[model samples]
Target: MKSMTSRAMRAIVTVSLGAISTAAFAQADYPTRPIKLIVPFTAGGGVDTVARIVGEELKGVLGQSIVVENLPGASGMRGAETAVRAEPDGYTLLLSSAGEAAVNPHLFKNIKYDPSRDLAPISLVVKVPNVLVVNAASGMNSLDDLIAFTKSNADKASFSSSGVGNPQHLAGELLNRMASVKLTHVPYRGAAQQVTDVLGNNVTATFASYLAVASFVEAGQVKALAVTSSERIPSLPSVPAMAEHPQLKGYDVTNWFGLFAPAGTPGPVVDKLNKAVVQVLSNPVTAKKLADLGSYPSPKQPEEFKSFLATESEKFKNIITTADIKAQ
Candidate 1:
């Protein structure tokens, strides 16, 4: 009986070693074929554009073609759910946005997958800050001025956002709480119409992604009051960050895109993907292109990216809960 028990234990050890060796070999030869990158938004959108750009760069690094697939719906949940359900192999990846990865889980009830549980964050591709803008002719030149104006014209003051649950929307809500002013939210389906309305003075102000509104800001159609970031972005050096003011001291809201693999993917495979992305982001040409879109291509390794997402998730959760934000 003792000899039989010892043999059983040895057999188990041998099987375990074999499995580990197979996993190691697989990781070493990852992307032996073309990889599919799932972008959970419509083609030509910010997330899709980023995925295609990164995919082009990654193709050269990995010596494998990256096929970008668009799966747009459910506030990005559809594609995300698809990615989560994919096999935990290195070939399938998700090009995720702050909405799908951090905000949507809290915004919508009965979300199919928990980002923290089902997705492994690889790297933060780019982060774009939202800016507070008023119609150029609105006569609101600073954050203080905007606050005072909103207070005086509480019934008339309004702000527009691309959508109800987007980061820009939350940023506006946060401002309302922090400054004790009531600027009613006016939700739009997309940035183009929202910016056009703001320019036409249909809304008193708007909180929008810097990239979405940068062209108008440059054209002098909208006056940027403050950016909702910790510091001033290099591209818009003249605009101050909201945190610079004492009343809005803790304000920081920015939209970011990240690369993710289904949870339980091999660690070495995740590392290889991270290394390839880090190299892509480090390229000057890529950085310049991202900058042109008012996005900063800042890549963080797997663990670092995971930590950053945690912080962002908490921040959004609080804002959504306190503001009583709900999915549309």
Candidate 2:
């Protein structure tokens, strides 16, 4: 009987040791297969471009292929939800825009995943400044002019956005709230269409990524009124920021992109991804490429990025409430 008891205890100990060994090996051999990086927006947009660049760099750094998948729908909810439900093996990750991670939670009534609980923030990839541009023929020149025009024609003036509850929409809503003006919102299928509409004078104005409409603004096809950043963008120094506008007191809204992994991914795996991201964002070439697109590389540590997202989520929640924005 004593011998049998001893054998049982030894077997239990061996099984525990084997389990520990397998877990350790799994952590060390993370990404032994290709990794999927899901972008919650359409291809050729700012978020998609950043994901491809970072994914390519990660492939080189991790010695594994990183595949970028664009699953654009429901203002980036579909792709984000897919990433949230993926196995927490560090093999499937998300590259979500600020709207998906920060704003959509407050705007949408039913979210399939919680940003804070279902996903782990890896790093902030970049922050893109959204510029307020109007068709040159529309005669909306400066921030003051736009505000006056909107106020004077509150019922008639309209603003275009990539979609309802997107960053562009939020920026416009925030502006209306702060400036005490009313502008009808015209939601488009995508940013490309929004830009085209603004350029064609079919819409009164639009707040979009400078990279998307910089050429049109520079060519005098569209007039840049103000940026949503706290400071002037390097690419468009002449245009002032929303904060610079007296009527837009304390207003600052910039779109951000970040990386996330499903919750329960090992800490070491998260660290590995964070390290690779920091290395990529810190590269001068990468910085320049992002800067050219009217954005700046963030490259924050995982904890800091997570904290930042929490704060941004709170901020957007307040904005959505104060602006009286409703889901459509």
List candidate 1 stretches off by more than 4 Å: 1-16
The best candidate in terms of TM-score: 1
Model 2, span 10-97: residue lDDT tens: 9999999999899889888887999999998789888888888888888888999999999988878999999989999899999988
Q: Model 1: what TM-score? A: 0.95
Number of backbone clashes in candidate 1: 0
Candidate 1 residues 204-302, lDDT tens each?
Answer: 888877778888988998999999888999888999999999998888988899999999998989999999999999999988888877788989989
Q: What is the lDDT of residue 9 in candidate 2?
A: 100
RMSD of 1: 1.9
